[model samples]
Target: MRLVIARCSVDYAGRLSAHLPLATRLLMVKGDGSLLIHSDGGSYKPLNWMSPPCTLEVGVPDDDAREAGVDAVWTVTHKKTADRLTVSIHEVLHDSEHELGVDPGLQKDGVESHLQKLLAEQIERLGDGYRLVRREYMTAIGPVDILATDADGASVAVELKRRGDIDGVEQLTRYLELMNRDPLLAPVQGVFAAQEIKPQARTLAEDRGIRCVVLDYDDMRGVDSGVPTLF
Candidate 1:
C-alpha cells in the first residue's frame, strides 16, 4: 500500500512536470491546508486567476435510454490563446471491475493533478499575461513552487493541494506574506486549489480575496455521477 501511494505520487509529479516545460517546479498543498508548490520557481502574477473560457461536452449512451451503459459523458475543455487542455471526466470513473474503493485522499489526488495540468495549459495559452520565467525562485522566506512572469516581471503565487484544510490556508497565507514582502511580487493574489473546500474556508478566503475553488470532478458512469449528460 505504501509503495502504491509512493508510485502514485511519483507518477503524478512527473506528469505535471512534463506538462509544464515553461515551469520549473510545482507544489502540492494537501487537504490539511498546507501548500505543496514546486521548488523550481515562483508564480507569474501576484493574483493569478483561473478565469479561462471552458466548454462542457456531454455524451449519451444509446437511443434506448434504459438499455444502455453509462448514462452520460462529460468533457471539460479550457482555451487560452494557442494552448488548449481537454479532459474526460469519465476517464476517472471507477467501474465494478476496478473498484477504487478508497478514502477521499486517493480519489482527490487524481482530480487535483488534472486540474493543475489544465491550469498550467491555460497560463501558457495566455502568454501575454505571463510567461514561464524560471524553474525555481529564491524568496526571503524560502524556495517557492513554479514561478511565472508578466511582461513587466511581476508574479502571482499558485499553490496546489490535495485537500483544502486549515493547514492549507495557513500555508497559503505564509506564501502570500512572502509575496507581499517581495518587491517583485507587488499586487499579488493567492490561488488555492483542492478537491473540496469547506464552507467556512470559502468565507474566510473571500474575506482575504484569496480565490478558493472546489475542484468539481465529473462523474458519468455511476450513481455518484456529476454533471448530467446528453445522449
Candidate 2:
C-alpha cells in the first residue's frame, strides 16, 4: 500500500467526467495498482478511485500546470474500459508505502454461516410453507445465500448478511436478475434477511421490491435446540 497525503486536484474522463478541486487529501495506491482518493470524512468510502486492472503513469507537470502550481501529474488508465483519471499534486505533505502480505481472504466471525444454517433449517420462519431448496444456491455470478420456495411454490432468493446493507441488496438483485433468466427459476423473488438491517438499506430493499426480514439469533438458536419460538 502506498499512502500519500498531499494538496491535489483530480479529474476523470471516459465513460463519465468528474472533477475534484485542489484540497488536502489522502491518496492510496494499492498493491493491485488501483488508486483511491479519500477525504477525512465519508466513512470508509473513498471520494474517487480507479479499480485494479489499471495502470498509473507519473510525469512532471507541463508549463501550464507548473504555472498553476502543479508539480506532479499521475495518469491512471483502465485496462478493460476507456476510463482515465488524472491527479495533479501541488505539494506532498506525507508519503509512505507498506508491504501487506498476500491476503488469504476475510476471517469470518462464524456468525454469518451459523445464521445461514439456522435459517435454512428454520426456513418456515420466512413464512408458512416456505421450504429450503438449497443453501448457497449456485448461479453464474456467485451463490445465492439460500434458495427456497414460498407457499405458492415461487422461487425465493434469500441473501443472508450479518448486517444488511445496500450493497447486500444490490448483490441479491444481481443474483435474482441472473436466476430469473433460467426457465426453471424465472420470476424469482428476493428476501433480504439479516440479524439487523439499516434503515436506508431497508428502504432500498423495499423500493427494489425485496422483502426485508430481521432474524433473532438467540430465538433461532432456541428453535434449533427444540425450544418453542417466543413469537
Q: How would you encode candidate 2's per-residue C-alpha lDDT over 128-222 as one tens digit per residue?
A: 99999999998999999999999999999999999999999999999989998999987899999998999999999999999999998878887
Q: Which lDDT tens digits does candidate 1 get at residues 24-55?
A: 22222233322222332355431111123544
| Candidate-wise lDDT, in order | 0.46, 0.94
Q: Best candidate per lDDT, number? A: 2
| Local lDDT at 185 for model 2 | 84
- Superposing all C-alpha atoms, what RMSD in Å does each candidate have to the true structure? 24.8, 7.9
Judged by whole-model lDDT over C-alpha atoms, candidate 2 comes out at 0.94
